[model samples]
Target: MKRPNGEKNISSTITLYADDGREFKQTFTIPLKANTPPPKPGYAVAKTTGTPAYYVLCITVPDMDKTAGEGFA
Candidate 1:
């Protein structure tokens, strides 16, 4: 999931599962280095602090977009 800072696009596929044991796959694209904001259901960059710094991918889920909700991973 590593890309150059000057890269212009990010694409990836994600899999999700339901409580009933059903699975789904979705492909998404996010534009980079654009004047306007990226589209919804994109991702944000985060950093971790410690001996070695690492980047984290914080994805945005449209269905889970709420002000108050419990988080689970």
Candidate 2:
């Protein structure tokens, strides 16, 4: 899905789908803070400057495929 680009900050969820028709739901918390690069490039990298939480859930399916452009397995 296409996202809106503007000066206003917005927080949304991003879902990553697998080729097996399984999807992983993740809620993203975006911070409306200033963007700054660290002294070192690889030191820190984030969509925005804030704390982000991540949770992983297990999905049991028969087959799993990780091919690009392929809809499902």
lDDT of each: 0.64, 0.49
Cα lDDT tens digits for candidate 2, 15-52: 67889988777655656632432232222332544467
Which parts of model 2 are misplaced by more than 4 Å? 1-7, 28-73
Candidate 2, residue 66: CA error in Å?
32
Worst 10 residues of 2 by lDDT: 37-46
Number of colliding residue pairs in model 1: 0
Cα lDDT of model 1 overall?
Answer: 0.64
Give the Å error, residue 71, model 2: 24
| Clashing pairs for predicted structure model 1, backbone only | none
Runs in model 1 lying further than 4 Å from the true structure: 1-39, 65-73
